[model samples]
Target: MSDLPRLSSSRVPTPFIAFAVLAILSLALAGCDGQAQEEAKPERPVLTIKVHYAPQTPDRSFVGTIRPRIETDVGFRVPGKVAKRLVEVGQVVDVGQPLALLDDADLKLQAEQADAELRAANGVLAQAQAAENRAAELRRKGWSTDAQMDQAKAAAAEARGRVIRAERSVELTKNNLSYATLRADARGVVMATAAEPGQVVASGQGVVRIARVAEKEAVVAVPETLVARAQGGEAHVSLWSEPGKTYAAKLREFAPVADAATRTYLAKFSIPAADDAVKLGMTATLTLAEPASERVARVPLSAVFNQGHGPSVFVADAATGKVELRPVTVKSYETRDAVIADGVKDGENIVALGVHKLDTAQKVRVVSSLSF
Candidate 1:
């Protein structure tokens, strides 16, 4: 009763059995932990994002050319040989400036002869008048007949008429002589010269081409599809030769009918002032600003994906760090960009690159690079 029986040597101890149960439990727990870790891990994908931004203003682009506001073909009123050329090509000439001279020797001689004839006619008229007065006096004194006096008066009248005719002829001859010299009607630059010294030109023949130097204009032919974009307002113009230099112009007018051959409308813009650098036939580019509408977000054209039904973009939510496919409406499409009218908000991040390979409701790692 006082002493317990000795335990058998081959019997397992209680401490050892407790240790085996604990070891089995530990192995089971480790397997469960491994499964949970595998399930908790998320599939990460590489992606790029572009934030939606509000456009400061809308810009419209157009192709155009530069031209003079007033152009004319200069010619002489009378035909003659070109005796002298007064102005050279590209030379600026003022009003009343002599541009060219024609051979006028014959005209000058004709004018001188007409003047001499006029003087002779005047002398004959004076003599006839004196004789008519004497004949009237003789008729009153009964020395001459009334019919003879009347005839003398008729002769004097005829001589007076002849003198008037001769004076008019002299004036005509002088005018013809003056016509040989060609003069500029307005201040302009000589664009082209069709006649040279010693070349015979016909009346009204185009001898020189000139463009007015006071007012300059820009002429642009807009396609039918884009003609509606041009409005009567301010526009920015640039020259191809001069990069980064811009000039301000006002839209003057647009032709009502489109050109039959080109199917484009002609638009004219008035430059503020005459610039020496600006010349006729120079190429130019015009940029007109579009009217302001409701504020909307815009993104690059590459960021937009056309999914048959509509346009859409991938948006990454910052709160949950998740990417979701969202549909958007395109307000306008430009050369290299698109303006989103709806389906996105300001400051929202959008997937720009690697959007084609993404799935709906996927987690993405945003890169630091930004797109224009």
Candidate 2:
């Protein structure tokens, strides 16, 4: 007993030692719990965009072709073999310019025949007139009967009718001979030629295709949904070769029916300010600008969040640095963005990415895309 060492005053007893250990353990456990709580409520950094509202003047563009306002297919008025094609494709021609010539041998022969028939009719008339004069002179001497005088008058009248018909035949043949040449009715550029030097074409067959360059137009196929808007909207045209230059265009014609295959309406927009540079068959872009439409917010597509309820977005509070899942009315989705029709006020910060991991009232650090 004596040999056992007495505990010093500076040393604690077993109970106190055990109590101290327990208290230290409790403090350590509380500290760990507090640290875990702090770590769990982390400040998540997210990319965000500022919301801005503007009148959606949606401009729709369509590929089109520059064309002429009036295109006509001219052909010869008389049937004959094509002798020569005077104009080639892309040749500029004026009104009354000969485009093609037909073989005029047949036409010339018919005219000669008509002239010979007229001469014969004139000779017969002369003979009849001389015979009638002789008959009248005999009747005056009382040597001619009344029947003979009547017969002479009828013969002269019939010969005069034959001469009148022959003269009309000569005029018809001359007109037909003039029709052997195909002429341009309007000043334009020739687009195509169907008749070669030796092709035989009937009357009214397309021999040459000419497009009037006085007025140019942009032709495009518009979707059925935008037909009405396109007609009332202002149009502008730009050529692929000259993108910087734009010509004001006006809607001139719209097809009443939709095309069967494409389900689109054919629209022709006249370019009153079109210059010579706007050539036929050039690729063009037609843009239609609508009047000020409804105001909407366009947000990045990744900012939209959906969890079986509808489309919503996480809007960050500027003051609290917290995010709130907001229900938004999405009007439409485009290639890279979604158009928000409503439920988002102007000048709000919206989380632009990582919306799936966000929750209501979650604290976040709003970072701009430019910061990167």
Q: Pick the candidate with the highest TM-score.
A: 1
lDDT string for model 2 (1-372, tens) is 999999896787779888999999999999999999977887888888888876587689999999999999989889989999999999999999988899999999999999999999999999999989999999999999999999999999989999999999999999999999888889999998888998989989999999999999999999988977798887899999999999999999999999999999999999999998899999999998776578888999999999899999888875688788889999999999899989878888888988988877578887664210
Provide the overall lDDT of each model, using Cα atoms, as 2-decimal numbers.
0.82, 0.90
Worst 10 residues of 1 by lDDT: 47-56
Clashes of each: 0, 0
lDDT of 2 at 341: 88
- Please tell me which predicted candidate would have the highest lDDT against the true structure: 2
lDDT tens digits by residue: candidate 1, 230-306: 76434788888785888888878889999999998889988886477777778888887655546666687877877
